[model samples]
Target: MRSGPTAEPHGDTAEGDTAGRAGALRPRRRLLVLASTFPARPDDGVPAFVLDLARHEAEEFDTVVLTPRVPGAAADEVVDGVRVVRYPYFPRRFEDLADGAILDNLRARRSRVLQVPALLAAQYLAVRRAVRTGGPDVVHAHWTVPQALVATLAAPRVPMVVTTHGGDVYALRAAPLVQLKRWVLRRAAHVTTVNGEMRERLTAWGVPESGTSVVPMGVEPGPAAAARARTARVPGRIVAVGRLVEKKGFAVLLDALRRIDDVPWEVVVVGDGPLRAGLGRRAAGLPVTFAGQLGKDEVLDALASATVVAMPSVPASNGDQEGLPVTLLEAAAVGAAVVASDLPGIRDVVHHDVSGLLVPPGDVDALAAALRRALTDRDGRERWQAGAGRAAEPYTGDRIGARYRAVLRAAAGQHPD
Candidate 1:
């Protein structure tokens, strides 16, 4: 079968030719991407997930993105060929009996609480804008909760696809939330997830099997990626990517680092989050160095410079988990051997003893041993690196983009009976 985005290849030639020629002769499908989280700054990786789809699909489609605008986001702009429109939100505020703003001693917590309504309103406004703009063949939502809810409202008049990344479904399975999620899933023309676990969860939650699809996330190797891989020299540098959070298991990795006393490898942690200060404190007086947050090129360079990539992910306290971290794919695509925790999403990305090695989640000794083996054994490292690079091929933006095109086309009711 012809892959990528080709015209209705199996349908009637005359009818097919008309739409195909129309699409190719001028512009292709108009795609609207919906998401609650998008890149607000240069160093952010959140939008890269959605952007990869837009960039690859742009080959056969024109793309527009609707994202929630916070205080920091640009109202409108184009990034990497994707047109982004951000909408502002006004939050509900609580007031005391005196009609003054309820005084909360922990001002930060109060502000965080107040921001939820605004975020939700912005997402709803994004959906209204997409529906009003009126050109996309389909609306693709990046997460299940707010975006899915918005898509559900917009789908009665237009086709829509919902993608469940980690938090969308997993983090909000409680009473009313679960009910709401079910309603949205029922309304979606199609649903997609990057891992088996998420697919299973959605199916169990009452989403029809036919409507659910498993399309792993993908990466686009930069021009220098292959050349850098060919000339990789182990600097005894160990690297970890992703936001500094418990599920990422930076603390567990820190404990593992303490166990490997004799190894001279220097640990370089990239990405930032709420847990940075705590994680930094945990690594105090050790060989660990926090690179804070870094840009895409710098992260790739960090992976290239490392002897091994350590991803000690675990299920978070709230049951939130990784949904195939793109960092793992990026590291592997650049030919770096990886040692990842054997968690659901992480395991899906890093195969044990194949692309890379897997160790028990939160086991300091096991992680340390895997790190040591990756760093010390040259032949083992080479085998793992080659396997990692090959494994990364399926997750590349081109391959993954093809899946998106297929799913969206099918979801849009464009396919013939």
Candidate 2:
């Protein structure tokens, strides 16, 4: 059976395709992708990088995604030609485990941690059923905690590729979790990390160095059409985009903005999360607009018209940090000046004073100074924008997608011709 561009109900069944003119059905390798967060609908404001990666991999394989189900999402659907199957782990109302932000949800309520067992059990059973039915050549599991653990338990015989985004590597450092991660890493055919620091951490945690690769998430900044000329941009308009979580440092940005009131600037915060109400209260009497959770086009439009893109990311109390923020890369790709915190993952994307200004993390005064400079120095901003565009060249979706495809194929024991 060959998978085609059609939606199928969630079950242990496959659609048969007709033979081609050559009187033979083309055999495509099957891939089962395990992830926690996915777009619930077409217009959902969730990050679409995993969806994009599956779409690109679909070019060379029959890709199927297994993600946690939300209230309004379809049980099964074909998105961008990739088949998606959402598994229900809890009641519609109680399905907060993988909803908006996993880390934030757990941090907001310690009781939410009790949901982890059921979530992992449901995901493992679903993956087992999918593997038995779909018979994928390889299982691609995103995040180490639940997905990789589920894959290791459900489809131990299949070659598995595990990818860690950040939180799983940094935040979940308890002894038992670390031991579980080591067990999963030992079983995986290969492991991929979004940044070099994560790979080093994995090795430090006893994962073999030879089994890991660094593959950062990729973005295709379509064309520079949305990029505005420096003189055409708003003089003092600042834009910040990301989930309104503790790690995003929006509260700190608010403090920095308060200090920089001498400048004629306004900030647009473009995401929604558990901290929205509190962040709004913090932004009171400040020129900050809470444009809650915008679509991609609207975000690009906001970036294009801004004087600077501010991403003051800091380590959350639980040790959660970024894994190379896509927003910073998008800002660079769109020729927007950037002011961000100096951290491991972010440093890989933004070079201090070259592509963008990097300030000490959690320092409101330093962030204020950097933003003031980016807002006032037109020539410097132009130079940084040019350098940023150049720095963003290696991260185009096509290039990164091809690299990932090669790794996946190799892991599945199929080498490219």
Candidate 3:
């Protein structure tokens, strides 16, 4: 990618610089990322994939992240070499939109619906501020519904690449909201989704096939996971990790465990969310341990040491489904034999009887049977684990980062949206 001329925010050579300034000293390009989910602190337990991607963008450009401000988070801070700017929407006491996730938060609390207008207005102002003050050459918005829409509203002339994570496409499907999504997508210079199924959805929306691509977030099999992989795997040890949300299918997982109680398998559930207490109450007597949100290394180690990993994800009641669960990829990286739902988005990782066993979403009996096979059938489990490891090779941080860098470089060269 060609580096743009070195220009600081508020300097004479602004976005409208003349040819003379374009000849100035060359420097890294600027990437302004808009996201709704980010870790407040280094160990805040929120998903760090956005931060990981920003770290990658920082390798080739000056990456800046603009996200919603949550309680106890800095308004501006640097995380892993990426500049993060958090914008406040509501009162500090009442700002609950980015608590866990925008969709999950709304599903958990009905009163939070009142905070939508404030959030939209604040995000627009933030994007406008980021564009004017940061002088970003291109914008990368993580979700289409509000982030991309807000970027277009805030800086219509700025080129943007919209990334649809999940809820933005599946949950926000009301007639009016669908039009709004299409409006933002049409204005985007390039659109990227985490899975092929979503790319097909984009094609169905009349988005040009040439302008869309599937680029998923990645996981690195670092020393922690590698070291754990060398350790002896525990027998009948099932591990599952993700937010305890309805889409995560923790309730269904508990039901599956109920049927498999005759087996000698034990489960360790990692992560936390609104449904934690309810899930706890439901898993009354099973040999289950609710290990609330661990660090990335810990989660990876647990996955690496597990005999099997379970991801019985189901579509949430509000129509929200995962674009592709990062947990699925992480499990693959650690070579854990997996039993996951046969969702379209997940097919990229979980190949039935190949990479891992696949059960229909929300099917407790099928999930139970798959788990039973993984626990008892050693040869098949090893074969599937090896297949998962091979499937995960192409999704490492280095490869995904290069792909994203290429897309951003292309968008940066395009005319403003």
Candidate 4:
């Protein structure tokens, strides 16, 4: 690891294992990251886990993030030493297909489907540009379908590592897409998914198990995060963070909150999505606050302050489900007690009745009972929080970042120090 201080705010204030990696300057290999989703800024609450991963990678690579363009965001810029290149996929006004996620955009407005061909073509062009200009040693494609497909086409000679977040492996299950996904994986030097469930899915699709890995986009566990959990834990506060969408199971969370009338709990839902308006209506007279989307610092603050974190994720109608939601990781990092669905991804990290309580995805009674137990039982909450912090240790940003960095370097025929 480079020895020196990090000019970065997040992991900069490194501690424990990462504290030794500070105050260093060195030129390193170049890395090209192709993705459908990325933060417009370092702070904006656009799910910055990708950027967080990139920031850590920047320590080892001259990282360049190429993502679809959004209105008001610059086409090219640098944030926290990492270069960001936003490629125009559709018309400036109609470029909403990439942000808020492609699947969500299509689910919200079917007309957005018209932009898919344009996005794919434009992304391929962007990858070509990145290959010629950045001359990256290896390519890191964030999603399987379009990003990996385009990367394989655009940078055919470059060794690439493909990382599949939840949607690509779980949602895009049509026979043609499944075949296409398998085809794409063949080109990757190595494949990584967020959880073992997705790894199993990828292998069943014919991806060799030996060549694949499970690496969740991780959280930065620092003093600030720990303090948030410690401070916000009083008087019973429940925080749920995720896009207000079907797969997130926020509707189920609301129902569970309603059922727990016996507990004196206040709810804070921190995200905005297509279902926000309807979800707001459903919340009705509950002690809930729609905090909407929050920036990274604010989100960490919220997570830190939360006594209990709820991740009521369920399988969407399209087969998309939680492949280890980042919210769960962040909550664990911040030392918050979690009440989550008993999904495979969640099952891997959250030990049922150990790190947190687990209930069936849509079972209102079970969810309510779990939430109520968390709120009323102080000893259990503390124990769960302690266990959560331990569970989250492997997923610390510095560790996961180094793991991914090693993978990318190995793909490029190099080795980590």
Top lDDT hit: 3
Report the lDDT tens digits of candidate 2 across residue range 322-383.
Answer: 98887877788888889999988788878988888999999999999999999999888988
The alpha-carbon lDDT assigned to residue 183 of candidate 3 equals: 84
Q: Which residue pairs collide in model 4, if any?
A: 3-23, 4-22, 4-23, 4-24, 5-22, 5-23, 228-304, 228-305, 229-304, 232-305
What does candidate 1's lDDT look like per residue over 1-417, in tens digits?
A: 012243332233443444465454433567788866556766554336777677766655567888755455577887776778876665323311111111111122445555565556666766776667656778888887667787676546677888887867667657898889989888888999978888998889899998898886788876338536555555788999987666789999998888887768899999776687888889899888888777777778788888888999987776777888888888888888899988777776677888789999889889889988888888888888898888887787767876787777677655523
**Candidate number with the higher lDDT (1 or 3):** 3
Q: After superposition, how far is residue 230 of candidate 4 from its true place, in Å?
A: 8.1
Predictions in order: lDDT: 0.73, 0.82, 0.84, 0.83
Which residues of candidate 3, in runs, are more than 4 Å off? 1-25, 227-232, 414-417
lDDT order of candidates, best first? 3, 4, 2, 1
Superposition error at 21 for model 2 (Å): 19
TM-score of each: 0.87, 0.92, 0.92, 0.92
| Separate clash counts for every candidate | 1, 0, 0, 10
Q: On residues 245-299, what C-alpha lDDT tens digit does candidate 3 reach at each position?
A: 9999989988988888667988899999999999999989888999999877778
User: For candidate 4, which ten residues in a row score worst on lDDT?
Assistant: 16-25
lDDT of 4 at 116: 96
Q: List the residue pairs that clash in candidate 2.
A: none
Candidate 4 structure, TM-score to reference: 0.92
Q: After superposition, how far is residue 293 of candidate 3 from its true place, in Å?
A: 1.6
Q: Mind giving the per-residue lDDT tens digits that candidate 4 earns over 1-417?
A: 122333222344333123123213234567888888887765778987788899888876678898999867888898887788898877787779988788988999999999999999999998998888768888999988789999999999999999999889888878898889899997799999998888988888888998999988988878446557456455688889989889999999998788876668898999999999999999999989999999877777787777788899999999999888887888888878899999988987899878999998899889999988888888998899899989999998888987887687689776423
Pairs with backbone N, CA or C atoms under 3 Å apart (clashes), candidate 3:
none
On a 0 to 1 TM-score scale, where does candidate 1 land against the true structure?
A: 0.87
